[model samples]
Target: MVPRRRGRRPWHRSRAYRLARTAVLVTVLVTVVRCGHDMPHGGAARAGHAAAARPVPPPRPLPRSPATTLRVPSVDVDAPVVGVRLDSAHQLRTPPLDKPQLVGWYQDGPTPGETGTAIAVGHRDSRTGPAVFAALAQVPRGSRIEAGRADGRTAVYTVDRVRVFDRDDFPDKEVYGPSRRPELRILTCGGLYNRRTGYTSNVVVFAHLTATR
Candidate 1:
């Protein structure tokens, strides 16, 4: 008989090869488990992706009406309130100063005499001196705010409270929320003035409609 040549067994019948393959398979499974936490369908990964994909709702609309005039008898603020358009830049337009006191309405928001929070902004001081709203900080709760509209209607509001806020932390919701009773928000710069940072805070007066005159 011819001498048989030595040769390797087929993989399915090799004990050493089977052990090596099992080792490699275990290593690969371990690596996948270690990194699976960060995979897109993993628990933490799914939460992160959902949060990033969520949409933010748009801001609510302001009330609407004809142009109106605002008057605060306690602070001696009487001016023709002109509508400040809501521009793409999202800025509150400054009213023209025919006199020292002119209140500008944020056109994007609720109009005076409407059942919602209406914003009226004015300059705290002019180049000459303290302008309209110079005494805004002194306005107390229970004070009256009046708005006279060109459509032959008048709305009266009572001061509810006043607050100061850093521009960075402006309470946009509370200051601009909808109301069953007409509301008013008076905004102006107050607090310490920083040469580099501009005004440190904003003075806001909150008032609720008391009556229509």
Candidate 2:
């Protein structure tokens, strides 16, 4: 990750995202979320990460801009982004399964670099094989996540924690809550895979803005 510049520009203060993130983001595939047994999946990936990170100084938020790309170096995920909306069922929709390499941004929420929790979701793996976020659970704390904005600026976030939650007990607030500072959440299906119920957990990566360029 590149070091943040010392001399910073003036930042804009904005409100937290007010829309309730009520949509259950349970799968990349609308019907079922699946993952192969080859790698660390689900509960096994929930190693405590709170102790692994260094304290980060707060960073000012940038003006709202649609994310164009998302890059997670540790996970080897580099993909173009598309806006995802909630379906009539109020379920969060994902990118096309055929485009396994693409990531979906919650278009109804805050844009990356804004003063709120922005969200991005991707498939852990698709039929084509390991997809964009296939290794998301393995991303270590303190690593950087870059969200490229349409404005040609980039918002750099430092991973604070990585956790896997049982889908039945997913925390709606903690994972999708509004924030005073610019924050981000990267999510994917995780935990154990069950034939009848699909993946049992949701892998969530919590990160906060540390720099912009």
Candidate 3:
């Protein structure tokens, strides 16, 4: 009777609905992003760079020379270093419990200034009293570590990080892995001390060569 409406005036195609949809479409926004690793080409790249944003190169590594002493000023540690090897149980031996003033260096690895990882181990305490690295865990990042070598040169390193690990689950690869740049690892007993079991964890200081004298 109403002039036979065409499919009841299809709601989707009505003028009111079409105007609302067009308004929504106009309000929508789209953004596209692309990431790249390659540097920009030509002089345009140089013009956009600021002096402060320029990256500085790392220091060059020094020649091999056994470490003779170790110093950590932040914790007031200055101890003579002596060569130490793995014990019968295949563990890197610590300095003699009796000579708490001494630091033990892992002789199998590169010297402090050399282009590889070097290690120094000391006791955190002994039955007598506090030992060489007693406050090693307190050392903060950016602290200076100096290693006196046999060549009468000092290999200066800046502390990067300090961490404590349970002795049973120590990470061998991450802690002692091969490194192309000069590196030093300082270790001492840490965590809880048990009357029967001694220390439950190990404190390690990671550092890298930064200067020499």
lDDT, residue 10, candidate 3:
16
How does model 3 fare in lDDT?
A: 0.65
Clashes of each: 4, 1, 0
lDDT of 1 by residue, 60-151 (tens): 32335654788888878888877765333323445554344677776655566676666677766655677777788888779888888776
Residue 98 deviation, candidate 1, in Å? 8.1
Best by lDDT: 2
Sort order, lDDT high to low: 2, 3, 1
Cα miss at 153, model 1 (Å)?
1.8
Off by over 4 Å in 3: 1-54
In model 1, how many backbone clashes occur?
A: 4
Tens digit per residue, CA lDDT, model 2, 1-213 = 111112321000001111235322221222222222211222333356433344555667888789999999997888999998766544556777667789989887778888877888777676558878878999999999999999999999999999987655566678775677888988776776644335556788999899999
Off by over 4 Å in 2: 1-57
TM per candidate comes to 0.65, 0.74, 0.73
TM-score ranking, high to low: 2, 3, 1
Residue 137 of model 1: what lDDT?
85
Which digits, one per residue and each the tens of the lDDT, describe model 3 over residues 1-213? 001114322111111111111111122112111100000223334566853443446677877778799999999998999987654433455566568889888776678788776778776665577888889999999999999999999999999999987756666555666677888888766677544344556678999988889
lDDT of 3 at 194: 48
Write down the TM-score for model 2.
0.74
Q: Score residue 178 of candidate 3 by CA lDDT.
A: 64
